[model samples]
Target: MDPSVIATLTAVVSAVVGGAAGEAGKSAWGSLTALVRRRFGTDAAVTAALEQADTRSPEETTRILVDQAHADAEFERSLADWAGETARLLQYKHDVSNTIGGDARITGTVIQAGDISGSVNLGTPGPPERRG
Candidate 1:
């Protein structure tokens, strides 16, 4: 199983369980459950694990899915597909909306960003300014 796939599944599960994904998250979660049921419905343990996702840790649920994916090639492919789709849906939920309105005045540089991972430099380095 790919690490990225695991990361995506973890994120989606966290978002859905945390109630932060909203309608898109709910839909993605539903799709995931349906996919699991279609692929592993006969397995009572798998179904139970999925059913208890909200109560159990996201990592645990993810582990169950990952383990099953490892056993079945087709299930791995389907799981990857579900992770990809869910990732896109979750991305939509995180759309950034930046706005400066209602008589807002700008003085200097105004930087707007979303989901920045590392340090952000807006300008070149300069000597410290002295105040008398």
Candidate 2:
């Protein structure tokens, strides 16, 4: 709407509300005064909105949080699915293919393939020692 019209409405509402505030049954007036104070005196709307937001029903709060969690979960799943699909399409599976036997050699730290490390090396293991 027009800024001037909004200002006029705000002033009228504030005066009416300010006039009614500070007494019994003053919520309506208090709200109006709050609106005025929010615009002119101090930006109290942020504070008021925060305060009012706290009054939200427990169900509403839970619904909001649940919605957020579900969205996050779906987003994560979509990313994982996309990554797997991309990998498959890019033939990353073939990266591990070994069509010929003895093509790779296995080496180990001599960690006792047997019970005793008799002359066994205490290093990490690689592929089996065979070349096709």
Candidate 3:
């Protein structure tokens, strides 16, 4: 599994366990649990790992997920898909603090953004400058 995926999973687990994810977080957690149940239904150890995820550190949960992914190619693909969807769903759930507080001087152009998708032009558009 990719590190980003692991990180996202960790965040999802934390949010869900901590009860800070709200409805969307609950939905994501349900989806993840369903996926695991479907994939590793007969594996009690896997199930136990997931059930006790909240009791363990995020790294431990990540390790169990990564180990499972390494063991099963199909599970890995499914997990990746779940991670992508969960990340999208939980994008805004993550706290973002873009503060320009306290004594701040004036600036020409100040842009503060998070998770930008498209191009951002901060300067006036003009003809290309000629060089010697």
Candidate 4:
């Protein structure tokens, strides 16, 4: 299985699990299961794995994804594609409000809009800055 695919699925699974806790978790889990069913309808193994993930803990769901990926190469590839697409779709659906990464600092107001298609980059311009 491709490492990138595995990584993508891992991330998607984590996001799904993170939302599997309270009243909000219930709603999040429901949405996730619906996505899985809609995308992989009639696939017995994937369907079974998704069912298990829904009922089991997040760690268990991660284990299931990894194990299944190892067991079936073709399926693993499909899962990676599905996971990447699903994650993107979910982000759009939820209207990703904010995202921050690395040690970059933000002290001023920042606004971003993705009307149709747009990208906002706040990374340091020019050469990388050295840190003491």
Candidate 5:
């Protein structure tokens, strides 16, 4: 497996586990976990590991995943493939919103991914003249 894939998975696993472990973050955590389970339920080991992730610290969670990936070549490949697919999907659905108010002006071009599906409202549309 490529090192970058491993690295990306490590970071993602750690972040997801860590966020879900916190009390205040449980709602979003639950959503994230469900998404993972729904997306990658074919692998029993991966499912088991993810189920156990909620109880572990971020670092430990990452360690467990890394160990599993290292020990099982197929698992590693599967994980890397999942991560790439997830990233692509996220990019496809990613949304961005930008606003510029008052006399502020934005210079240069703004690059957006996902084909710029989100909004960029520079200002409100109204009558030409305004008096305070």
Candidate 6:
């Protein structure tokens, strides 16, 4: 199975604020079953998916790593991975190039990270060097 499919599915599965990973755990199985049925015989597919909801099954449980625990982090990582994969898939379509011409430039200076938030602890200050 393509890992990107798992990643996309994982992102969707974890989108809810409070959700369980394996709640409706049939998605992966269903997709696999469909694929096998399309390619091979029903008997092979049936044998492949001997049990629908077996706890010991690695295929059924592997998705949990991406879908449940530390979901935000995992989903973000998965998203980045999938994005890279998609970019690779579309590499031939759009060439990656720097948009700014050699002479083109921004007139204003670029600001650093801590240059925006004002001050959190404003006890001592004199014409601040940086915003935060």
Top model number, lDDT: 1
Q: In TM-score terms, which candidate is top?
A: 1
lDDT of 2 by residue, 22-132 (tens): 232144334433533443355453334324433654234323323333556553343334323433333321123224247656564322131233564555789898978
**Model 1: CA > 4 A from native:** 94-132
After superposition on all C-alphas, the RMSD of every candidate to the true structure, in Å, is: 6.9, 26.6, 6.0, 10.3, 10.8, 15.9
lDDT of 3 by residue, 1-132 (tens): 788888877776777667666677778878888999999886887787778877987678767877999999999889888877877778776545588889998568888876788999987799989998
The local distance difference test score of each candidate is 0.86, 0.37, 0.80, 0.62, 0.58, 0.40
Show how many residue pairs clash in every candidate, following the order shown: 0, 9, 0, 0, 0, 0
Model 6 clashing-pair count: 0
C-alpha positional error of residue 7 in candidate 6 after TM-score superposition, expressed in Å: 14
TM-score of 6: 0.24
Score candidate 4 by lDDT: 0.62
Residue pairs whose backbone atoms clash in candidate 1: none
On lDDT, the stronger of 3 and 4 is 3
TM-scores, all candidates, are 0.69, 0.18, 0.64, 0.45, 0.45, 0.24
Where does candidate 4 have its weakest 10-residue lDDT segment?
20-29
Better of 2 and 3 by TM-score: 3
Candidate 5: tens digits of C-alpha lDDT, residues 38-118: 655656765666677767665566566667668777766666776666544443443444566799777866544336457
Model 4 CA deviation exceeding 4 Å by range = 20-49, 95-132
Candidate 6: residue 26 lDDT (0-100): 36
Worst 10 residues of 2 by lDDT: 89-98
